[model samples]
Target: MSCMKTAENVCSTGIRIKDKKLTWKRSWQKYKYLYFLILPGLVYLIIFRYIPMYGLAIAFQDFTVFGGVFGSPFAGLKNFKTLMSNTLFWQAFVNTIRISGLKLIFAFPAPIVFALLLNEIFHPKYRRVVQTISYLPHFVSWVVLAGLLDVFINSSNGVLIMLLKSLKFNPPNIMTSNTWFVPMLIVTDIYKNVGYSSIVYLAAISSIDLGLYESAVIDGASRFRQVWHITIPSMLPIICILLIFNLGNILDGGFSQIFVLYNSLVYRTADIIDTYVYRVGIVSSDYSIGAAAQFFKSLIGMFLIIGANYTVRLFDQKGLW
Candidate 1:
């Protein structure tokens, strides 16, 4: 007891039971309003995000519906081995990477470029309108947009095909073609969220000291030169931060969009882990296998997030921690 007391005294700065309780009391008193506001979100994450973690144990079991989660006999390494040997699962994984890769290559940079261009516009009313129009799509649900996209890209009555036919050119309905899935993914993602994504960059740009721009203008720097020399460089830290955040999701294939837009016609290239999980798990009633696949996806996501944070720290010396 004496030795334990001595160690505790030496480490007194660390959180002890009484100290932690007092700290919580102080924090609660100081930020009661903020805590109140965050209570709902805290409950939400706990209910939707954290609580569902119990289902993950199915990945290790036979997980029959009749036997139930706890009643199911444990079958260690069985489901995981099956996942490893499955060709279709691998194909779906590859498609997810391809779609997400294209999104990063095209969708990410387009918003930054758009934000930069908008920042340069001198017309106030036009700028606000542009921002409003651009930001609007981010609020639209994929369920609605997928139906609209189907209508707009229908081979017979679609706008693009109609315009092309008017010019004596015939283009295939790209939505159902494997060859166009990648570009479609990029274009649709960019069109939907680029405006809202640019909000961060716009905020970063606004925070940059205006005096730098004034000095650049006095030196006769052209608008393009000013943006290239001052704006992008000033925005580098935030850009890197955003890039790191994006890199952490290199495998998420935007499940809702793909599920709504895709049919077997494009499954060769369009199918992703998420959609495959739905088909094989819910439709086929293979809960164990589905849980295994989900576990793998979560593992990959964790690695990507850690790797991205590490890369950002290496380049900029700051990370989420």
Candidate 2:
């Protein structure tokens, strides 16, 4: 009986080794090309993203450039308390929510609606031209666009400001004014991104079965009716999923646009977490405190993403798990 058990154990070990080898060989045979394709992306994520995550330790310490991440003394929650106590931080927090909320309200639907409008266009050549024109601004750098925006809204010399002045209007510097900061962010963001954003909707629209539209046409449905019932509903799932993802990013605001466009004049209304972090960390060299601020921002983002995903799942089972 002992001899038989030993022989069985040896046989099992041999099978396990064979299975491991076979599995490796099969995987290589089936997906070697795919693995090669993914290798660079994996390396990029590891090097650029994963490696930098080590810096998160700065959030816990009274860190300095000389002190380094581990060399610094722990400050407990003092940085957090300082963050909470600051009136400016609260104001910036409110602005982040308000600005991002407004953008979501207007900008989110703009692309979907624009895509629907464009999809209704029957002329292929004109549609292509419109697509190209609309897409052009998205590729334009925020720095260049900010400069152009400055040209259009310069209080003394911009085209629109000049026009307003001609009309006997005391035009505000829309680019630098507190009252216009959030509005400017939303409008410019929509302008730059709406077409590119609409591309997804366009793809979704184009993928809908042509048969559905034909059947609707046969049923005496007008074009508008078909779009309302057929097109909109067909795109709802993609919209919802994209919306779920977008909600996670709303607090980010437009860091680049806001940073480029804003001055001390609009800082009260325009300061976002990212810009604040940059100012605190790199500009001011308050490494430890900046890390704390950044950590706070990341925590909020994490909650936003999780909460948004949860809400989406509650409303619709098709959600990110």
Candidate 3:
């Protein structure tokens, strides 16, 4: 009887395994086209993102150009020690945190506010026009925008400077001013990204069930009340997710824009980890130090993401896990 019972358990387990295989086979047959569609993106990530991670090995090596990654002698913690001991690196670290924090405080909410206001617009055509105009700056490269800013705000004879002079007010060259450069970065970053970022919130808003608004209306709720009670709640999940993503990227201080817009005069205020790494690791031909800096930056970002995800989950929201 014991032998018969064991035989029955084995047969049941085999059937369950067969059933799972069949289900998976059917699922694959149904979604083969979707798999094919994602194949290119998967390939791109593997090639460009994952494959380059192998080069991080140089972070612990001397990493001479002639010796290359493999041939370079391992220096272990020497590169990290050099990085920690550098005062310029510490300055850049502080600047990166301050710049990113300022952006987070001001720029993070600009899109949410913009999207809320735009959603309140009853005129569809006007809304579309505004979106198009705002999105135009996002499509423009930072290089182009930086040049435009130079002409409009930084140049001695620039339009803004000329306008200020007409008002009998002396406007300092903000591009070179350590005090104003960070503020300039925040404002320009918002102008460049707010419209594009609003698109995500707008999408989240659209996905909200119309029935919720109807119920709110029946409850004698005004537009503001409906938005506050229903629309905002519906958007919470997406907002949390985006907040997590932004927090993860808190260390990245808009390198391309800063690199193009900043000069040696403003380096005290504008220099970030990325720019410092470029100057030290690339310009100075110290690949190991550069790699080490990048590795630490990426490590911090990863921890930020994990912590953010955990916090979001604590609020009962879905996380990347």
Among the numbered candidates, top TM-score falls to 3
Q: How does each model score on TM-score? A: 0.86, 0.86, 0.87
The candidate, 2 or 3, that scores higher on lDDT is 3
What C-alpha lDDT do the candidate models reach, one value each?
A: 0.86, 0.83, 0.89
Error of 2 at 109 (Å): 0.8
Best by lDDT: 3
Per-residue lDDT of model 2, residues 146-216, tens digit only: 88988898878999989988999998767667898778888999999999999989999999999999999
Model 3 residue 189 lDDT? 98
The pairs that clash in candidate 3 are none
As for lDDT, the candidate ahead, 1 or 3, is 3
Q: Which stretches of candidate 2 lie over 4 Å from their true place?
A: 1-44
- Per-residue lDDT tens digits of candidate 3, residues 112-167? 98999999999999999998898999999999999899888965788998999999
